[model samples]
Target: MKALLSSRPVLWFLFLFNLVVAAVAPFAVDGTQGLVTAAGMGAVSLGAGAGLLRGHGQGA
Candidate 1:
């Protein structure tokens, strides 16, 4: 379980999911607020992924 959590593939999958969210949010939700919220979420996800990559197996 610890190994899986630190896997690069998992991080890539998360990034890809965020990309999809960025693409779909505009059409699925109305108003600028949704986009801003999604962008904020994306930034957090990106930061998390970066941290995981930087720390590598440290957390595990």
Candidate 2:
């Protein structure tokens, strides 16, 4: 778990995936659908950032 959490590649992949989702969310839907999609994308980014911050301060 520590090894995976510390990996830069995994973090980068998550960041890129969230970015792509946010980019496409507006055009792919409307009304509540677009709002929900955008919220989900934001949540993923916030969660990933929080996880990275927490992992950085963790000690063995």
C-alpha TM-score for every candidate: 0.56, 0.61
- Local accuracy of candidate 2 as per-residue lDDT tens digits, 1-60: 967855656766776688678778878887788878878887786777766777786664
Give the lDDT of residue 7 in candidate 2. Answer: 69
**What digit string (tens of lDDT, one per residue) describes model 1 on residues 1-60?**
967755777777767777678767777888997788689768867865795679775743
Residue 13 shift from truth in candidate 1, angstroms: 0.7
Q: After best superposition, candidate 1 residue 49: deviation in angstroms?
A: 5.8
Clashes of 2: 0
Model 2 sits at a Cα RMSD from the real structure of 3.3
Clash list (residue pairs), candidate 2: none
Q: What is the C-alpha RMSD of each candidate to the true structure, in Å?
A: 3.9, 3.3
**C-alpha lDDT (0 to 100) for residue 18 of candidate 1:** 77
Worst 10 residues of 2 by lDDT: 5-14
